[model samples]
Target: MKTSRQNIEIEKGHAFVTIGMFDGVHRGHMCLVNNVVKLAGDTGGISVAVTFEPHPRMLLSGGDINLRFLTSLHEKEYLLARAGLDHLLVLDFNDQLRMMSACDFVERVLVGMLGMKHLIVGYDHHFGYGGNVNSTTLDDCAGRHGFDVSRVDALVDGDVSVSSTLIRQLLEEGELGRANSLLGYEYILKGRVVEGKKIGRKMGYPTANIEPDWQFKLIPADGVYAVEVTTGENLYKAMLYIGTRPTLETGGNRVIEANLFGFDGDLYGKDLTIFFKHRIRGDMKFSSSELLSKQIAKDKDETLQLLG
Candidate 1:
């Protein structure tokens, strides 16, 4: 449960470690973690996970900042803890660590810093500077380091490999049901409910707006979703909207808005976690505000039924 910024000496004991950025910790990642935990249990080693912060992609490419995220650090930690892991090592993704060669990474970070006796990586394990390291190199390195390696077989369901990218694609395509199935849980996005133009309220569909911590947190496709809204304490069945308001005569600014069904309470400036259950409809351009309002009502009813 200890989170350290400076490197801590790897406790002098055997440990099973799973390595990845683990952005969403979706089904595939969970598989790896579970495998490590089970293996560690058999080997009398600690179950540990190594993940990077500020996703390496963001550090590598300063691309579009608004990619929606499936989970925040707090969410990831909570999920991992629930999965029965013993330790979660969140390393800072910085240039210094990035420069380490594959061999050095295995020796210094995984072995020296983590004291991993068994290393469990995904089927396609690649790491080190420029990602030039592969499975062969890892096997050789493990042999030299006197540790065990477990390469988890690819986790696939028919045409789809359970992956963070696949989950992101599903979300982008508004495939909430399929995405949730692959994720093994509801796909959630964490953000603080912030102030917004009072457009939804004026239209009689008040919204609790969300502003995520990372701009690059990948958002699902622009659509209305059946959602469960949690503001750290209370959970509510609701309709969540993620899109630019086309009906409102305004500049196109993408926004995340959620309408809690049959619940009225102040949510301004509070953090909210939205769990997407199903996609109801794609964002649309209505002929009139009245038309948009009518559609919103229908969306609400659909979401209510979905929750039920």
Candidate 2:
């Protein structure tokens, strides 16, 4: 996919566009993206996804709030490209753009700058300053600009709407199955191996400390999880831990580390991408190192049985 900043123009044919933060690029977002692709394909036009940088909330909050997102900008671009979009237009979102009325945005940004022939949006997607215009009102704005508009229905599973917020809640609650089901894929974290206190090593379970790539990336609930780790071309079944280590009593900061079964090598400085598969159990504090070791051994057994 061709990524363009700010304004975009198609040298040949028309531009069919969809607009959103598309945070996490969840299944709900994919439904809209797929529709755009289909429309563009049927009309022999270009499919475009217009997204904002820094997330609208980050700018709107004016440094008052630190927001976590499902995917980084790089990850979002990669997923959109794989979803079959012809172009991804990243708009620089600032105060001026945020204050623009929904009607003006439809005319100036979507219609004027992008020359959007067809506009697509999620079922409840809103427009204008502070989202004054919703999906229903968008059609009238589209009529004024002489462009077509389509709203993909909300993807519902068991009476709940599949959304970024829902997935985030599920992850933070350690509900991997529900989150992964709505995401249409496993949640992942990319990080570099860092040195730890070596307590796990003394207990005969060596683990590599992980430092996540992005501070704004959400960490799931503190617990032991069955995970798959990928580094270079190698993949390993591993058990992951996220907690403040009440047992160790060294510091208050939460630590993320993994022990890869059957792999014995130095991991410091190496990058690893962890795909969370299952939540084995919540963080537990044992009275002694020996007790913790026994529990870890049991956790490993359960992890192996689940992975197999």
Candidate 3:
């Protein structure tokens, strides 16, 4: 797929377009994307997905919010390309676009820039000047611009509808399995291994300390989890720990540490991604180091069983 960043004069064509932040690119978002691609392909039009960078909230909130995200810009681009879309346009959510009304957005972007023949969106999606646009507003815009508009129903995962917001909530609540199901993939945290105190090494469970690549990427709640660690071209089953080492003397800042099973090599300064699979247990404070070590062994066994 072709990608174009801000300020490019797009050559207008018969295009089928959808616009959104598409955070997490969850199953619900994918449903709408698939429709856009299929509609464009069936009618011989270009499939275009217009997404904003840095999130509208980061800019609109005046940078006062501590916002976290599921997927980084690069990850989103890869996912969109995998969805088989023709074009991925990354727009800046600047003052000009933020202040524009629904009519102006439809005229300037969907009509003037893309020459969109059809517009697709998810059920609850609304946008333009404080989310003033919805299915009703889009229909009105389509009448003016002579473009067809379609809205896909919400995709349900188990009992609840799949959504980026819901997935974030699940992760924050330490429900990794449910969140992964909603995402249609594992929740991944990519980072570089950093130097850490040898607490785990002394316990005979050496771990690689991770510093996440994106500062605003969301970290799952404190817990012991079953995960798959990927580095270079190799993957390994691992038990991940996310919390302060309360059993140790130094228990302050939260840390992410993963113990790779049956592997031993230098990992500092290398990039790694942890694909969270299952939540083994919540963070707890043990009475002594021996007790904590014993609990760690149990966690590892449970993680290995889950992998099997």
Candidate 4:
């Protein structure tokens, strides 16, 4: 909760800053942020992270129909704060600012606007209009702007680079183990628990349903998952489903429904966080409600075993 909105000025001092969209604040990003903090600590400087709002890709693409955010601003800020950053600057990614030249961007924004004394950027990171800016030019701009730049190498898993895109692909394909490895933690979705059709309760597997704030937030591949559910107040082991209920003839809108293992109360309208642990099985359509109920019972057993 330690954050200040006022523009910062480091008087005759050094500072560590890294720039990125920091989409999910995944493992790779944590490595960069942690390094920045470690380096800044030794120099008696602040560890600052500079991120943009409304993702740059969404802007450049004229708004993609498939565009999804991994984390909302509130989630991103919370993650960054937990990673021990001294300050976070969430800049508005407007068209005017987006059109600046690489050199101009470095001189003005990195040095003038934020007063960054030292910058840590990823090896393959690009910036400025058209993303034509590279690390070499960043160093050149740093020289002129009276700042220093260090390139953090890409974090890799085997031959694959640990990136937001790769993590998204993993989640989309239902590879929770690999995704969690790359993320350094389970992938989690946060939303407000809402009213559902009450079908689960009738079937004996009562579920708490979450309605997402953003329609375009990417959901993991449709499947059953062993999960840990959390509210701001408590955590519970649960089984979560992410998909359109094929067996129930529920069309299109993907539902995130979870059955808390051992407790129940009126949770409708409460904020819920579901942490993905493992993929149980791919979603399937059943011939009858009875058959579907049988499968769900089996899924619950498997989930409880997984949790153990």
Model 4 Cα lDDT, one tens digit per residue, 192-267 = 9888988789999999988876666778999999999888889999999888898887676778889999976889
List, residue by residue over 203-265, the lDDT tens digit for candidate 1: 898898889765667788999999998877888998988898888856789999999877788
**Model 3 lDDT per residue over 1-308, tens place:** 98898533545657889988989988888998999999989978888999998799899888854799899988898888999999998988899889999889989877988887888988888788998987777898999889898888999766888888899999999988889888988999999999999789999999999999998899999999999999989999999999988878565899999999988899999999899999999999999999999999999999999998
The order of the candidates by lDDT, greatest first, is: 3, 2, 4, 1
TM-score of 4: 0.95
Off by over 4 Å in 3: 7-11
Pick the winner on lDDT between candidates 1 and 2. Answer: 2
Candidate 1 similarity to native, TM-score:
0.93
**Between prediction 1 and prediction 4, which has the larger TM-score?**
4
lDDT of 2 by residue, 80-173 (tens): 9999999998988888888999899877878788778898888788867989997657878877778888878999989999999999999998
Which scores better on TM-score, 1 or 3?
A: 3
- Clashes (backbone N, CA, C under 3 Å), per candidate, total 10, 1, 0, 0
Residue 71: error of model 1 in Å? 2.9
> Model-by-model lDDT, in order?
0.83, 0.89, 0.89, 0.85
Question: Cα lDDT of model 4 overall?
Answer: 0.85
